[model samples]
Target: MHLYFLMIFFAALPAWFLSTLEGWITVDCTRAAVSSPMECTVGERFAFSSRNTRYATWKARSASLHRHDRRGSSVSYQLVLSTASGEVPVLRSSTGSDKIERIARDLNAAIGAGSTRFSAEAPPDSLFWFASFLVFLFAGVGALIALVGKRSGKS
Candidate 1:
């Protein structure tokens, strides 16, 4: 009976983890004063405009939330220039103000305006520990269920 119940409870695990993921970000994001929310990944490429001046993109090489949704909480990307034709590289510059740095500064200002900054932060490992605990709990329950089944059969 208990083992069966344990198996069913596993179904709720996803919801639990999702809540935890949001809460985890909420605490840290608030600390950093970032805007409402933006999906971010460590290595994935992301694009955004700063101070409404220019658009930039950054690649996320690291991620910590453990799961990938259609998007993440917040991410960073470098700037890329596109042309009217939208063909190959119309123009490109890296991390400098001429275009990229100016944009970055504008964005940084807007974000910093309300004590919030647009930056990508990786999730910590506590999330994984919860997952591991859930797995182990179920394994123990399964073993218990088998033990009971064997004993009842003998009786």
Candidate 2:
């Protein structure tokens, strides 16, 4: 019975989790749209705040993660950026003139996509599914065992 429960938890718990979770990723590429002081690096994760108001809190407004590539210049940069309160954080967009143009074109495309900015959210907890599965499995097994014992006149 417990084994059955464990299997159920392993299988059914993920469904509950999938239903409950809203999957979203923050991908900020431009800084000028941000309202807060922005922090950035190539291979590092940093916090980006909006410049909306120094004291007043501004919720995470938008974010974008994108790569700008230039064919002739051999220049490309991957950027993740966000903005709030209308501050647009700027990222390095070019190695030279052509690169700049390429970057601009890419940004323009992002704008046309109608989702130029993104909202930042915490990383998804993968273990959420595991935990939920375990909970369901254990509870189901325990309940089944209890039911069987009750029918057999065993407390």
Candidate 3:
């Protein structure tokens, strides 16, 4: 019935969210000159100290997302680290066209959060998950209503 279909649809939403969660972008922290390796997320700023004598410490001010298309056949996503001094080439990864675009868009928004100019906003993970949970909860409510209706002999 419609309620059953709704339940299935709602159940799949969280799975979809989980599958798309940061799997598209593969960050390579190995090339970094840092003393200790570190992992980074999209909406965060990371800082680390270099192993080299010079350029002791560095902070990643923002992330620049790029999409390069080669020969109109291949495409790649590159995440460049922006520091106080200049830009540094960092992570290079591949993903689906749609997913890469979404990641780039979100990265830009996170980088532009504090600027005075207008910027697009990406929804926080907490808010997105909460909303997904509500939909799942409502699907259960719908199933209960359907059961009640069936028991009461009303179509």
Which one wins on TM-score? Answer: 3
Ranking by lDDT: 3, 2, 1
Residue-by-residue lDDT tens digits, candidate 1, 118-155:
44322323444565567667666666776688689898
Query: lDDT per residue, candidate 3, 70-122, as tens digits?
Result: 64554333334444556554432223234434544444453344322222222
In model 3, the clashing pairs are none
Q: Model 3, stretches more than 4 Å misplaced?
A: 6-28, 32-59, 63-124
Angstrom error of the Cα, residue 96, model 3: value is 24
The whole-model lDDT of each prediction reads 0.35, 0.37, 0.40
Off by over 4 Å in 1: 1-41, 44-123
Q: What tens-digit string does per-residue lDDT give for candidate 2 at 1-155?
A: 65465456555654554444322222333333444332322221222222121111222222333455564323323222333444433332211112323333454455445442422323323443455556566666767766676678854
Instruction: State the displacement of the C-alpha of residue 80, model 1, in Å, after optimal TM-score superposition.
Output: 17
